[model samples]
Target: MKINRNFDNLVPSYLFAEIASRTAAYVKAHPDNRLIRMGIGDVTLPLPPIAVEALRRGADELGVKETFKGYPEYEGYDFVREAVAGYYRSFGVTVAADEVFISDGAKSDTGNIGDIFGADNTVLVTDPVYPVYVDANIMAGRKIVYAPCLKENDFLAMPDKSLSPDMIYLCSPNNPTGAAYSAEQLRAWVDYANEHDAVILYDAAYEAFITDGSPRSIFAIEGARTCAIEFCSLSKTAGFTGTRCGYTVIPKELVRDGHSLRDLWYRRQATKFNGVSYPVQCAAAAVFSEEGLRQVHENLAYYQENARVISAALDEMGIYYTGGKNSPYIWLECPNGLGSWEFFDLLLNEAQVVGTPGEGFGAQGEGYLRLTSFNSRENTVEAVQRIKKLLSSSV
Candidate 1:
């Protein structure tokens, strides 16, 4: 009957909650100000036309008694899973259909996957990490260690042989920082995890945004299948944020303490989850179709262009930043020595622009800020111009 007291250790507010609170307050005070939000990585584009058509067709099938479906398979529909497998192959990575488990989204999978491991296992996460990685382990009362992602390392935390943690969480095209790890960098981690008998929870939610040569999957590195479980979402990939369909890849080769982790995950889902709806899975499968891919990339390019506008503005302002080339985020240091929240307030008050304060992410994020390219192109262009004008005048 006792509640998990470990929850007491978590911060009082989730990062986005605090940001929303402040934004609401600002809007109330400056009711006439037209605020442009370049925060919260939520996609602004509509779902791809092909996916929309697929969803409609799937729904139509359900209306007919012959094609009606009860609860879906816990792992996902075979067509969706197989489509995901084929999608991986497009990037030169091998993924079997059975290895893929459909879920609500990567956020849910990243937080819930910890359930498979023992509570006694130590967790290693990067500083300035996506908060879910840190908060989830804390809820389980596990000892958590951080690998500092300082500027010296280009914000990519490398493996350290001196430490041996049972579980490691990694995000590429990382949230908050927008830095991605190269295949060589990921290879080092795969080797480290295998040698130490640890497991890596790799989040590849933004992989579709990566146009550079960085790997689209961790399995692109050899030995990763033995030590890594990858989580991916179509939320950012194909604008399925609201529809909520994503997948997890658990290689059959990953076994720890004589237990097959893949089998354990399958059991976990079968027990506690009813699986994504048939129609949503149908739409997700279409994301792998040729026409679906073509439409999805067109939306991605629009966001990429927004990122370019923001980053180019930063360049003109001589602001040091990363991302916006292969990522939809622009992570920049607060200008004029302003602290994270200080810059947040200044930007909102001066330019009517809203961004997430980096301090909310973690200690290493204190003097930074995150701007997203998820808004409309018009809004993004206007936001950058306003930001440039404000900063230029101040300078």
Candidate 2:
């Protein structure tokens, strides 16, 4: 039997995997090096106390016969969905509880959602995007197109009316570039999708990090409900990276080819998926509670401070960059005209620090690098100083 030969077209190794391999080799050779890793967006903070307590309560409930749960609903529990709905309302966006589907995380939903659409549909994604968006579509053997997110546009790629794609992927406060789109800019994309009869897959995983007045949810834009499906995660928001819980919102009004996209997603999940753990959903629901929000924001504030420190150092170095204002990432141009991987190596060897090479994201990411604020405050401070000294020495 023949395999899905499309797999043959993918790159030999994933971006992060290659980074790990190189770092591993370095550590093996230099045993005394104290490496400070600022790569990979994984959070280093502990889960919020409120969520942890909720998790314990939910788990305790399972011990008694009355509260013992068998299998969970594919679309998640009513309480969790209601909490998510209330969260939308707080931000002045209305969302019905019935429309939310609880999942493992945004990463899973984003990669798996493509299963509902036709294989023949064309996919469009921004260049220098999170690799999952592009790689997943490649596995489906779909014809993929790239919208260049160049330096001139501040890394925000706009819709090109000339190209017609059946599906589009957009991440605000974008992954590698850390640039977000304004409401007026997003309106253009929503209108374009409606006109082209195309569906927009919007990733709002980093929405909570937004400090400015940018729209936190695509539903904040008018006409979006008719064309967009939003995926959000607690991984970055509430430090649920290891906890594994998030939600996907599909509007009932989003009908394509005369089929309710929401209904289609429901059917897809019910058939192939078992749903998130009851304890995790309970914890996720608490994330929207008053106390829960306060605790999570405390952790977020710490990361924001780390971002501020890094940004200040870059300012001193006179580096060209974006983000670290409303985002937890700093996307900077490699110093002294160094290429992406070249800078990655320089930081690793000279500064004993690590960051993602922008080239790993896509072609447009060349000569760029991405740094995260997910590490401890002390580590963040030290890493920036190390970077500063290394760059200064070269000059």
Candidate 3:
């Protein structure tokens, strides 16, 4: 009859939920208003042709008993695992097929991976991080402490060598803030985790969206395999938002108390998950194919253009913002001294557009706002135009 106490301390469902509810109410009352949303980071593109064909082929295989795969090898299809390993190698990061654990989504893996370690472990996480990282540790009853990732830090959290935590969570091309860590900054974290015998949970889900030369994978840093686990997802990369396919890289070299993390994650997946559907795995594998990679890049290029459009608009008006150069998100300074939510409301009421309020992310996110470049090209251009008008009028 007792519910977990951590549930009591947890904040309400994400900020997007409230935004949806508010927008829904307004639409119900004023059906004439056309709401152009730049809030949720979900991709609005279709799966590429190569991936689509792969999915269809997979479905055909399922139709024939000769190829109908039942209860996939808990680790996932070997073809897919090999493809992932190839990806790491191509990027100058070494990983083995056995080190890759396929999952339904990064959101789920980030939460379920907690089962591997004891609850007493200290979790050092960043403030204003992807909520899943922080919330999961608390749910597991772990000791959670946050290292501030404020504007002063350029939102790239660093290691506190003086206080080593058992586990650390880091996200690059960060959600909400859109800040990507430099190579040196990432190496410092890798060294710290290795020195302290700690693990760094590196979320590089947005790597495919990175346009400029940036370390797309944490494994780019030396000694990362000794101290880090990397998470990547296809949702943003190839428009799989609803398709839901992601992978976690558990290096064979990483160990704690003489137990292998790679082996542990394998066991965890075997017990709890039936790999992604046969069709999904096949589709994901095809993503590495020459044609698949080509088609996917096309979609990526389109979204990156949207980022440029939004960022350029902000720049022309002399508004300060970060991202667009390397990621699909643009973090803008809310006008004047308005609180994030206050600015959110102002945009919705005056401009008929909606953006995410950074304050809803965490305490450090106050006075900031987030806008995603995931809308249709036409809509994205229109949204930028409307925002510029609102800004000029307000100023």
The best candidate in terms of lDDT: 2
Clashes of 2: 0
Candidate 2 lDDT over residue span 87-146, tens digit each: 999999999999999999999999999989999999999999999998898899999999
Ranking by lDDT: 2, 1, 3
The C-alpha TM-scores of every prediction are 0.99, 0.99, 0.97
Candidate 2 accuracy as lDDT: 0.94
- lDDT-wise, the better of 1 and 3 is 1
Encode model 3's per-residue lDDT on 1-395: one tens digit a residue. Answer: 98898876677776778899888887898799888989989988889877888899999999998989888888778899999888777667778897888888788888888889889899988877677887788788898888877767777778876786999888888887898988999999888998898999888889987766789999889889899989889999888889889999988889998899888888888888988998888889999877888888899999899999999899898887888877888988888889989988888888889999888777777888899989999999998888889889888
Structure candidate 3, residue pairs in collision: none
Residue 204 error for model 1, in Å? 0.3
Clashing pairs in 1: none
Give each model's whole-structure lDDT: 0.93, 0.94, 0.86
lDDT of 1 by residue, 190-265 (tens): 9999999999999999999998899889999999999999999999999999999999999999999999999999
Models ranked on TM-score: 2, 1, 3
Better of 2 and 3 by TM-score: 2
